[model samples]
Target chain A: MIKHDLVIVGGGPAGMAAAVAAYDSGVKDVVIIDRDASLGGILQQCIHNGFGLHKLGEELTGPEYASVYEKKVRERNITIYNDMMVTCLTADKIVTAQGSSGILKIQAKAVILAMGCRERSRGALNICGTRPAGIYSAGTAQKLMNCEGYSVGKKVVILGSGDIGLIMARRMTLEGAKVEAVCEIMPYSGGLTRNIVQCLEDYNIPLYLSHTVAEIHGQKRLEGVTIAQVDENRRIIENTKRFIACDTLLLSVGLIPENELTKEAGIPIDNITNGAIVDENRQTLVPGIFACGNVLQVHDLVDYVSDEAELAGNGAAQYILNGGCKGDSVCTEAGNGVRYVLPQRVNTGTGKDVSLFLRVTKPYGKVRFTVKSSENVLAKAVRIKAAPGEMEKITIKADLLNNITEPITVELEEV
Target chain B: MIKNITCIICPKGCSLTAEINEGIVCVNGNTCERGKQYATDECLNPTRTVTSMVRVSNKCNCMVSVKTVKPIPKGKIFETMELIRGAEVCAPVSIGDVILEDVFGTQVIATKNIDR
Candidate 1:
């Protein structure tokens, strides 16, 4: 069995950043394993700019941002096993990964789960249609167009208004494809406001909110699609159905965390995030096993993923160097207007400042997020606008965390 | 003349009104300082940072990603793309290497390293 101090399960941004952080933190023996031939995960497929503004303080494309981390790993001489998949991960941190050669077992002192996420397929959307040649996921289409020199179709209709779909609308337009429309079932867009403006508004692409595809028209290669408006109940209105002739239909409905390995490892997954449940350090209930990045929750920005993975990397390094950072942990709850919060539990006595990232249930205007204990109000941040599309962050100082005598609750207060 | 401009400073997408009186621009409805500057810039000379890929030969992957060293005029996007379409670079290109100099008075620099 090959032994390593730390084994990271994905060579994406999260895994690369974690490997670098762990190496810098005095944990020299580290390896990053990915199923792809190269590093940089989805970032490679993402060629658009507007990344790394927060972390690196400069606007960078997806590959540019990822290459910086990949360079850091190479400078540190971090070992990597590309084109390898972890078949099984035990609770005790025994990783069984298979590569092109054969199955390999590795006993890791700590494992960081950075497997990231995958796109929700057409089957998840429940659209009644024949399996055709023109249908593609937004990510798949992006990979095909960006990496491989292939365009999916000449005429496109996007079924979801997520970032990928919106970006693809512009990409297809730039590549000489006509995008008819972008339909979103949600009242508010699932993508960021900047994308809506730059991708759709700039291209004059119409975005139909509270609308969805009711039926598929073509038998083989997606000749057309029937889109209909939906009422408050999200049920399609019968008379509002309209057929749009398009050769391609891209689905950007949602992204689910790739957690088959974590589930197989028996880590407790949160229902809301569909990722592992852990404390402030991004550790799972299973000691020596930690999770971060999209495997923990879907972040609106890649910068947050790198930040969270650093926490997990430091946590793993601490586990190996000076045992684990364990203390009396307290639970955190999403009280009002909050859909869910990450780091479901926080150890009060760890004496480290903890940042709680959360998303609201609905869009609110002129609101303040209040983080409070039973008797004490910890901190609050006000915003002019708060939408489900944007993820909000609230930092709880270490001194406040040290004095936490009750379960903390985060509530949105209308100002 | 007052023009309604959407501030692209961040994702907030604040709608601002830029009123010009004797060429002294006054921006209103901005939530942040960057928004005010963005409004003034948008009203005066709108510029955008262009990011596109260039063909790389010597079998070093498919393409090398590049971006303008500074924001260029918004109208130069087509001209820039036209030039980038015909541009090609050799292998072992380093980040920040100027692939096309004097591109509309700005250089198109590589953003990432590509080696064979």
Candidate 2:
């Protein structure tokens, strides 16, 4: 049995950041375990640039961002186990894994789960289609092209305007593929506006909003697809049916936090985020175990993921050093117009301003987000517009939370 | 005469109007200081985030990861990429590691793990 002050699972951005924070915070014995043969998680396959705008203040491709962190980890002499997949986690923070060598057991004083997330594939969508050779998830196609150097197809139709889809459109175009269109069932795109302009508009790829592929028409390989506009109820408007001949279909529908291990560990998972239910300190209901990154919530940018991971890392270190940060935690609730607030519990005694990250339920014009404790408005921020695609952050000073005995709630109201 | 300018700092793409009276720049419609700076720089020069991967040692299967230490002039991607490609490091990395410390005086850090 191996022992460490902090054992981090996943070894992605979240795990690496958490390990660094924990080490820098004074916990020296840190070990990171990952299933991948190497580190970087999903970033390795993401060759197209666009990441690190907020965190690094410069746009970087996935591998570029990951390399900087990897170098830091090496300089720090942090222990890392590659090709090691953690198979079991006990509530007491004992982790068991199987690697290329043999079985490994680790007893950690504190643990941070940075397993990152998984992309949703065709199986999750239940799309009715012949089990053809050409259907691929956008991410899979990206990996095949960017990392493996295999061109997926000559003609492509992307279903879902998620960032992966948009990025892939540009990638395929650059690879000499004729990208026909990117279709989305939602009225709005799930990707950033810049991606739409740079990846689609610049490439002259059409974006059909509020539309979906009604049927996949092919036998052995993709021959064509039928697309139609959807009404408010998402039912296909029969009259708007159009057929596009294509040899490939890529689904960028969505991403779900890979939480099978969390579930297997018996941790309470949030229905909305598909992550663990954690308080402001990023601690799961299970003591000594914390979660961050896409595993906690699907963040739009990697910068946010790094920030969240740092918080979890520091919090985990505090847990290892101070016996845990679970003071008299107060419940934080979401009020009107707000979709959901993370870090559901806040330990005011920690004496740090808590940043609440949330998304609006829908598009709004002229809205104000208010933080209240039933007695007074602690803080508020106004915006000319808000969208579900964008996340909003509001920081509540430690002093404001110190005096509040009741729960804090954040709400948005149309102004 | 009055001219309208927009803050190109973000995708929100806020429009800021500037009134030029006797060669004095009176700016309005800025949502934040970032917007104010963007409005001022939009006319002089525009900048963009630089992102590119650096080559890690063969220990990591010749993979790379990146971060922009700072923003640079717009359309300087290839120039920035040249610097990134030449920089190399041995692996077993961490978050926020300075891979190419001050690449052209820009602090480009790493954001993901790279196995050495």
Candidate 3:
């Protein structure tokens, strides 16, 4: 078995960032294992710009953003194993992976899980349809068009207004395909506001809000799809049905975090985030194991992924250097309009400020985010607008953590 | 005349009012300098960065992603796309390689390296 001080799984933005940060923090024996032949992961297939505006201070394409870290990993002499799929992970930090060369086993003192997430497939939707060609997940269509040069279809109808779906509307249009409509069951789009402007509005593609695809038509190849507006309870209204003729139906429904490794390692998982339960340091319940990026929670942007992975990477390095963080633990709750909050538990003795990342339950105007312990407000921020489509972050000061007498709760309130 | 514009420079999606009486133009409701510029420019001339995939003959299994080196006039989106449509390139194209030059007054360059 090959031994290393730190082993990072999946070399996407999260894994690459973690490896770089861990190496710079005095842990030199770090190795990254990825299932793709390249280190960029999904970013390799994402060709459009809009990443790195926050972290890198410049707008870059997905591949361009990933290249910045890839250069750092290479310059630091960190080892990387590509085209390798991790098959098993143990409680003791043992990783068994299969690659072109066969089974490879690695025993490590610390492991960082950054496997990211997968797209929700048609099986989850269960829409009435004849199994036909030309159906695709938004990301799959993106990969097919961006990475593997192929036009998915001539006439397209997207069944979700998520970022990928919106982006694909513009992409298909630019590739000379006719994008008829983008339907979303939610009243508000799941995509960022800019995507709605640049991807859908700029092209004049109609976005039907509170609507969804009710039925799909076609046998050998997709011929058309029926769309309908949903009621407040999410059931489709029969009178609102409309048929849109198209050769393709692309679904951009949702994403599920890839946490099979965390599960196999016996780490407790959060049903909400569908990721490993982690603390401020991104350390999982398993002493020497950690989770970051999409494996911790699905983020709307890649810039946040790099930032979160840096924490996990530094946490792993500290674990190797100073054993582990053991102290009084306090639980965090998502209250009011909040959906879920990260750092499920915080260490009171860590002597570091904890950043709480979360999403709101729904869209709101003029709001205040409050982080409080029963009696006192720990932190608060006012915003003009807040929505479930965007993740919001706030930092709880360490001094406030030191004086906290009760479990903290992060809540949103309308101002 | 006055027009309302939503700055797409960032996710803020600031709603800006563009006032142009005569040739002098001014914008309001922008949170940032970039948003202000975007609002004014959008009122004057709208533009967008065009990205799409081009077929590769040799690498029949994969397509090469390309984009205009700079933002093109919004009106020219379809015109530029017409130039991109039915176009094919050979495999072994590297990022930054010019796929189509002077495409609707702008160059279309490969954003990724594809090897068959």
Evaluated with lDDT, which candidate comes out highest? 3
Share of native interface contacts recovered by each model: 0.32, 0.12, 0.64
Q: Tens digits of per-residue lDDT for model 2 on A1-415? A: 9788888999888888888888899988989999998778887887666668677887566876787677778879699899999999888889999988589998989888888777788777766667778989999988776555567999999999998899889778755689998999998888776677657875689999999988888889999888889999888999999999999999999888988778888899988778999988799999889999999998877778889999998989888899777568788888898888897877876678899999888778889999998877878999887877778889988888777778889999899
Q: Candidate 3 lDDT, tens digit per residue, A1-415?
A: 9899999999999999999999999999999999999898888888888888889887777877887898899999798899899999999999999997589999999999999999999899989979889899999999988877677999999988888899889888877799999999989899888899888888789999999999999989999999999999889999999898999999999899998888988999999999998888899989999999987899988999999999999999999999878778888999999999999988885678889999999999989999999978989998888988889999988888886658889888899
List ranges where model 2 is wrong by over 4 Å: B1-116
lDDT of 3: 0.88
Clash count (model 1, backbone only): 0
Candidate 1: chain B TM-score equals: 0.91
After superposing candidate 3 on the true structure, give the runs of residues whose Cα lies further than 4 Å from its correct spot. Answer: B55-60, B84-94, B98-106, B114-116
**lDDT against the true structure, each candidate:** 0.87, 0.80, 0.88
TM-score versus the correct structure, for each prediction: 0.95, 0.83, 0.96
Instruction: State the lDDT at A260 in candidate 1.
Output: 97
User: Candidate 1: lDDT of A83?
Assistant: 86
Question: Per-residue alpha-carbon lDDT of model 1 for A150-179, expressed as tens digits?
Answer: 767999999898889998888787667899
- Which 10-residue window of candidate 1 chain A scores lowest in summed lDDT? A143-152
lDDT of 3 by residue, B1-116 (tens): 88888777766677789898776679898899998888777877778877776778876567777788888988998888788765788978877889898976789988776776
Which of the predicted structures, 2 or 3, would earn the higher DockQ when compared with the native? 3
